[model samples]
Target chain A: MKWTKRQRQPKLKEHIKEDPFVTDEALAALFEVSVQTIRLDRLEMNIPEVRERIKDVAQKQYDPVKALPEEEIIGEIVDLELDKYAISIMDIKKEHVFSRNSIARGHHIFAQANSLAVAVINDQLALTAHADISFKRQVSEGERVIAKAKVLEIGTLRTKVKIESFVEQSLVFEGMFSMFREEKKIKEE
Target chain B: MKWTKRQRQPKLKEHIKEDPFVTDEALAALFEVSVQTIRLDRLEMNIPEVRERIKDVAQKQYDPVKALPEEEIIGEIVDLELDKYAISIMDIKKEHVFSRNSIARGHHIFAQANSLAVAVINDQLALTAHADISFKRQVSEGERVIAKAKVLEIGTLRTKVKIESFVEQSLVFEGMFSMFREEKKIKEE
Candidate 1:
């Protein structure tokens, strides 16, 4: 089936969304277009390269801010749904390690989890009231940590969030955060 | 009161203990010795210089390890009394800051507090079960953070610890940790 440029672009976005890890070559074959055409469409559509696509998919998935400003979040939140779930990714670099050893510091790991816990709450203001956490293993420099925060329970004044961080498939850190949130106000008619 | 060299050395140690921040010149004046003699006495006693003395005072205040190995603590613990209180110090260097901005990352601060919280537990095995923490201010490169942990309550299987971090006199971070600890065992007669 021959497809015009206008028709293919929207489909390309949808195709990539369904599988963010899909390679450009595979996308070109599926779209029945030249590789160059696929590349141009992606560029015009402002889609990032495939590697970044894995981490960037969350950018468009949901509204990022409710409890705190986006800039205040420790990691780039790749996916979010307030008072439900959220995901963020952080790259460990030279600056995040101890000079004597290249292992990423533990607090860096905690900050990512703690911030994600705060970000997933559905209130205008959320403060962490308590947390229980463990370091499962050490993460080294050059590793990327993906932290997922899931809301366990919600109440008028508090929410419980469970956060687990992984380097690839390995669990590097885990925590449970009890967050204090301002009560949701009733809207005027 | 003419004190012999042997008598004066013990007194010097006592004086320094009373005030770890005492100047070498003050020690000389108090001990009725020349400044060079005071320096020699301090060196012979293996005392660190005054600048380091303030941060190092905790080294002699308590037994350092109960829950975890001393080396595993994120900051250099200078004071500790397991299940009671502890203090640690960390110097923020280039390696601990963001490359783009010199502000120390939030996790570094959290790690210091978390580790201190764990260190203060009076058990052979202690794990952080939960924490509620907040970063009060941004810490910059070259700043030194002092973290103090105090035990709030003790339970047969769980303990609560409160931790606070300061850069000099300014509060930088604070946290409350609920820790899980192995229960004490009774010795067989």
Candidate 2:
């Protein structure tokens, strides 16, 4: 019996959602497909394998706001093509365990969201002129957190962006960021 | 010449501003005293050194909202303990560097400030339901960032807090946070 492309895709999606964190070998066994096929499917679905997903999440969380060093960034794209304007992150590595007595530290998450928001603007240089954030939940190491940013309003001089961060699919931090584009120098001035 | 108790104590007030972040070495050298003496003076003045201050800042910036893990906090209490509900923090360390992209990964700063706002509430547990933040300037590592949180309004189920985070004696992030509080457990029918 031949499996239709439409049928196979839905089946793969269902399999992945059921076990969002699963190994390629396990998936290959369950689907009766080669590891290469499983990998190809995952790529098509924008879903990396468990280990790769974890690494992607961690690396994205820890990715710096800029590659260059300056007193401040006028406007630098950190997560280009993602259109995500802000970021939030956990400081400890995934190997660490959660402890009630241990605080995850707040600035790490806020900085992540804010930097992403700053990076999303269209300009050669943009600087953070103002920011505000609220922490909703405690985040621990190994927990998956994602930052979501939206453009609220954009103007010639300033653009406003809203950012929210979630850990384990729960909202943990929220913020609004504003960016100022550097003015161009006139040739005659 | 006899020196009075007031005269013997250094005029720390003159040298350090309210919510100031100073290094032990810097303080010691400035006063022409031993590091031990500076430490003792810091204790008396309720001022914390860079490391301790950073920890205090991180706690306010990074930790979860509903519960606080016990840890020794540094930084002098600069504002009046308002009866209406408020908390303030100063001098966030490496985390600040990340938020302003003064370093990298800047979202942590917003996370810290928002967490502190939630932690300062009088309720047993407070969860941030929504927030808006504005970034005013870039904050670097080792710079003092002060967070001031104030309750804007309170209702039966929700409370709103306004927070402002400052670095290098300048306003950097300002935010409004809305929180959900569970005052009593729901009874099952």
TM-scores, one per candidate: 0.51, 0.53
Q: Model 2 off-target regions past 4 Å?
A: A1-10, A13-79, A82-98, A101-109, A122-125, A130-143, A146-154, A162-176, A183-189, B1-66, B72-88, B92-95, B98-108, B166-172, B184-189
What's the TM-score, to 2 decimals, of chain B in model 2? 0.57
Question: Across residues B1-189, which tens digit of lDDT does each residue of candidate 2 receive?
Answer: 433436535566455554355556566665677788767766787776655665565555443333443331223233423314444455556534533345423454565565666566665555566666666666656566567778878776577778777664568778777766556222211
DockQ by candidate, in order:
0.22, 0.35
> Candidate 1, residues A70-93: lDDT per residue as tens digits?
877888888888888998889899
Docking class of 1: incorrect
Instruction: Show model 1 residue runs off by greater than 4 Å.
Output: A1-51, A184-189, B1-85, B89-109, B115-146, B149-189
lDDT of 2: 0.57
**Top-scoring candidate (TM-score):** 2
